[model samples]
Target: MKLTESNALARVAAYCSKAERCEYDVRKKLLGWELTEEEQQRIIERLRKEKFLDERRFVQSFVKDKIRFNKWGKAKISFELRKKKIPADIINECLGELDESELDESLRKILETKNKSIKAQNDYERKTKLIRFALSRGFSMDQVLKTLTGIIGNTDEEYF
Candidate 1:
């Protein structure tokens, strides 16, 4: 069923009102509805004017949710936001606002939980597994290493 312009606009507006949405998300929805480029543009403009669509707000909400709920690192969050067509500058500014200590704490907790489940023959293997897990979750090697040191202890042992 093809939706007329006004119906599409109302549906999109209601969608945006339910939760924050970026332009890319709205554009995708409009495109799926098979609206013409001009119609998509006009609807987008109206959404912006009425404050139903806001990229910055979307980015901020995304960052907060990803950090708190997903326990994701900066690299993963930044990559996801970029994928959503958010501006790099906005991503940087929002990520920069995160507390370094808080991020470290989040990493620490994640490693602690993971450490309990990992079974290894030796400390080296355990450390290796932990590092790989954290890295896969988008954490930097440096931060993972630092946090692991405190959790795993035995810092003198060489782990490659």
Candidate 2:
């Protein structure tokens, strides 16, 4: 079925209204509809004007969702936003909204749960595995080590 510009615009508007949408998402959807560049731009402009497509809003919602529901770390969230073609300033602004203490607490909670599930050979091995796991999860290596140190208790040997 062929969609006229008006029809496409309406469809895209409806799509954006359903949830927070970045310009990248809307552009991809319009492109899939076989809209020309001009048509796509028109629809995108209208969506932006109508408050349907907002990068800031999208970034905020994305960060909140990934952190609260997915338990993703700042690095992962930033990477995903970049993949969405969000501007660096907006990404930084949204990331700034996340409180450091809150993030650390969240990481601590996740680490505690992960630690319970893993059975390592010794304190060193456990700390090593935990650090690796947190790093894989996109957490800062330094922060993870610090939290691990607090949770696992300090030993004579250094674990980095």
Candidate 3:
């Protein structure tokens, strides 16, 4: 059944309070609730003015959580945020806010994980697989290649 506008607002408020959310996600939810575009915009404006919806804040929190808890690199997190319609300036700002040391560590850990999963391959094949995996995870080619080289150069052990 189609809910009244007030009911939808209350429900969305309850949903958003549980976690940080992006405007794109909230828009999708409003559509799911069968709200008209005009009504959706009205509620969104109200939310924005009241500080319930802040794009910059959402991008910042989203990037932090994805990196910290999910171990995602900036490329991956940035892509997701872009898909949410966040501005490039804000996206760049949040990415710039990421610690370089933490980013390097996250890349190293992902490389290690990929290495473990593809241990039976030859050197050429191994590198190919690792690069592909990291690419799929949205890591940059240069970072993946450099780290892969470093890891392989330091290891004398054969693949499993």
Candidate 4:
């Protein structure tokens, strides 16, 4: 059904209320409805004024959900938030909420589980594969190396 301005506003408001929404997300939805630029801007302003849309809130929720449910590392989470057009300061602020020790522990768990499933010719190959896997999951090389060192008990091994 074609949505009138008022109806579109109501629908967008409901959509925003159902979850945290950034301005970009709301604007995209408005555009999908074929609203004019003026109408889109007005609706966006209304949503912001009514507290139905908040970029910071969206960032926080998005970060928390991705970390807790998806087990995503900071790098991956930051990349996804950037893709959503969240500001860098806001992304940093949201990412700051993640505890360092918790993140390390989570990475440790992931590596341990992955190590068990992987079969390689030698310890060198295994360590190399583990590092590659962690890196692919968006963890920094430094963190992955440190975590591997702690888990594997020797950093001197060439495969690190």
Candidate 5:
């Protein structure tokens, strides 16, 4: 199947109109349209020239919505963008845009989710459970310990 330049531009225009998309995603779509490698590059370059292929914009939007709606951690979100063939430097730039407080809150929300599922009644057991959960959710031990200690240890009543 051959892809004409006009067809490719129209299709990309329609796609970008629906939502912000990264160049990698748009390139994949172009390939699906059976565009040749040169054709794909041409379309991508055109899109970039038109400001529809902004990488930083894609990164910020992706970071914002994933954290806000998907409740994803920096680790998970970084892993995902890396899978998309995004550059490591850009991924760091994107992750860096999130404030430390925002990261902690996202971690807190993850801890809450994990804690709610465990059957442990003792504070010790509960803390252990949270450590495992947050760690599995890709939080660092340091952050996990800090958040669990801060959120769960605010009370004096013995849970055991």
Candidate 6:
């Protein structure tokens, strides 16, 4: 397909209409289409002017979806957002809006479900596996430990 300014604008407008998109996402797509830097900038400005692009709205949707659907922790979601070139202030603000209790509950549920499936010879091994799993899921180590302790009961031996 031949890429032209008009076609690029049309295609990009359609893209943003379908889902929330950050400027980085749109810029990357334009880059892939080999649009000139000036063209990319113009289209971006047009999108913003038309209310088709809003960074705050995009961040809000991204954060909510990642937390509710993907069960992602702040660390993981923030990392992904950063990769997409979302500003730190926006990322921090959006993440801050999330309820801590809800996050902890989500983490707890994830760990509980994972604990059932893990096959370990001893409590130490089981706890170790659970911790690693939660951490890998973007949850903080402290959050994982606290949640794990609740599910598996407190032990005299520290399993870090």
If scored against the real structure, what TM-score would every candidate get? 0.95, 0.94, 0.86, 0.91, 0.85, 0.94
Residue 103, candidate 6: C-alpha displacement in angstroms: 0.8
Q: How far is candidate 3 from the true structure (C-alpha RMSD, Å)?
A: 3.7
lDDT over C-alpha atoms for residue 76 of model 5: 79
What is candidate 4's lDDT per residue for 11-84, written digit by digit as tens? 99999988898888887888888888999889988888999988988888887787667767899999988888
3 or 5, which is superior by TM-score? 3
Give Cα-based local distance difference scores for all models: 0.90, 0.86, 0.79, 0.86, 0.80, 0.90
What is the lDDT, from 0 to 100, of the residue 40 in candidate 3? 86
lDDT of 3 by residue, 78-137 (tens): 888888899999999879877877877777898888788886547777777877787777
- Candidate number that wins on TM-score, 2 or 3: 2
lDDT over C-alpha atoms for residue 39 of model 5: 81
Question: Weakest 10 consecutive residues, lDDT, candidate 5?
Answer: 151-160
Q: How many backbone clashes does candidate 4 have?
A: 0
Candidate 4 overall lDDT versus native = 0.86
Measured on C-alpha atoms, candidate 2 has an lDDT of 0.86
Candidate 1: clashing pairs of residues:
none
Error of 1 at 124 (Å): 1.0
TM-score leaderboard ranking: 1, 6, 2, 4, 3, 5
lDDT of 6 by residue, 3-94 (tens): 99999999999999999999999998998888999999999999999999999999999988887888889899999999999999999998
lDDT of 4 at 106: 78
> Which pairs clash in the backbone of model 2?
none
TM-score of 2: 0.94
Residues 1-160 of candidate 5 have per-residue lDDT tens digits of: 5668889888897898688888889887888888788888888888889888888888899999887787677887888888888888998997887888887898888787777788986877888777777766667777877787777775333521
- C-alpha lDDT of residue 85 in model 4: 86
